[model samples]
Target chain A: MTMRSPLSRVRGLGSAHSGTEHFLTQRMTAIANVPLVLFFVYLLVTLAGRSHAAVSATLSNSTTAIFLLAAILSVVIHMRIGMQIIIEDYVHHDGLKMSLMMANTFFSIAIGLCAGFAILKLNFGL
Target chain B: MAEIRTRNPRPLSPHLQVYRLTMTMAMSILHRITGAALYFGTILFVWWLFAAATSRGFEALNSFFDTWFGQLMLFGYSWALIHHMLGGIRHLVWDTGRGLGPAEREFSAWATMVGSISLTVMVWILGLTLRG
Candidate 1:
């Protein structure tokens, strides 16, 4: 006889033991963001009020493009996971929670891709 | 949950509403709020990047950003970002198990608040000076 209830068995409630992934990823991205984001801030502040050509020239640099892409990717991942945790905490309706989580994931990916594409465009002058 | 046919209205656990705000609790909530704000702020950042890449919308975007309303929004976004970053640093410190004491936690919260404000102001000052 199984100790699990019928619903538990049906729902496949066994622990995958990978629960630490979310917590760890959040922290990893957080650590990465500290430096990347600071660099991002510095870039923006230095580039403030500059002409479009100047901004373009700065971004076209290989090293600058690389760091910008890394910042966007890391920041978006961190943003997505953080919003999911917020949704889980405050949203009580299961259906709404699932939908919001899906939207959260999609939104993060969309913005990240947009930012990445732009950076590449500048990098290649395309 | 599967076996219970009748649901009982049992006592619910006390939530945030029941607790008074302390520096620690306030900081935690502020961290979440700032983080949430940053999520939207990032959208604007993406748009800025897109404008820069295309090289078409930069002038219009710059004009808009020079407006008072835009400056206000930018200020708020910068503060939220700075505060959230400081909060993350505090969490990193606490993760090492060295800042769990009552005094340490509270002090860290206060430090994050002050440091974020100071940094944000300094950044804006630097930005304005550079522009000039």
Candidate 2:
């Protein structure tokens, strides 16, 4: 076997794709999370202890329904993105990391769909 | 195969014990732990939404959350939510490169603690007032 030079051994190891994308995505999610969280906080504060009928009526309202839907969807997406980095950085097995990331994404999408459907079904009086 | 060396000559960096712990350190750890907690807590929101959307009435979801254990979980979640939000604001300030100095970092950490507690108290008071 041909021996490789030390220079060739370390040629591709610079900051060339170094953790920058992950850092940027984390920041992006942080920004997205802010308003979504605020919306959720407001919703919880307003809805606390309301009767079932009143709560249902509020959820049926277009404005509240849409805001809740948007907030929940954003939260799911944000959580998925945040956890992906945590897993990628910590989980050593490449196959496990990929599988876990895929699971996280799918789970978020499923949750988002269910949340959105729930809000819309109530909105249409179904 | 070549025999493996018993030990490396190069020194390794010390772990967590090497540094003194402070409020900032506590806050930093809390931020990540709270993040993970919130990740799980978020599923509850999804469940709530789905229950509200699909069920004929709110009883299903309401009763589940109205239970003692559920209420406890909710309270913990509320605390975590407020704590993490304050931490996020602190992180944003740090992101802007404004609070990395020692004194300012300490102030930010304390602010996170105080703000989260204050918000939690305010929400609980509001909940009780409305309940009454």
User: Evaluated with lDDT, which candidate comes out highest?
Assistant: 1
| Pairs that collide, model 2 | A118-B53
Model 1 clash number: 0
Q: State each candidate's chain A TM-score.
A: 0.86, 0.75
Correct interface contacts retained, every candidate: 0.58, 0.38
Each candidate's DockQ: 0.54, 0.41
In the range A7-99, model 2's lDDT, one tens digit per residue, is 776666554565687567667767776777776776676675567667777789888877777677667766787788678657866688889
Per-residue lDDT, model 1, residue B11, is 73
CA RMSD, predictions in order: 2.9, 4.3
Off by over 4 Å in 2: A1-22, B1-13, B17-20, B56-60, B130-132
- After aligning candidate 1 to the native by TM-score, how far in Å is the CA of B74 from where it should be? 1.8
Q: Which one is best on DockQ?
A: 1
Candidate 1 per-residue lDDT, tens place, B16-87, comes to 999998989999999999999999888899888999998778999888877898778777887888899999
lDDT of candidate 1 at residue B100, scale 0 to 100 = 92
Q: Give the TM-score of candidate 2.
A: 0.82
Q: All candidates' TM-scores?
A: 0.89, 0.82
In candidate 2, position A115 carries an lDDT of 77
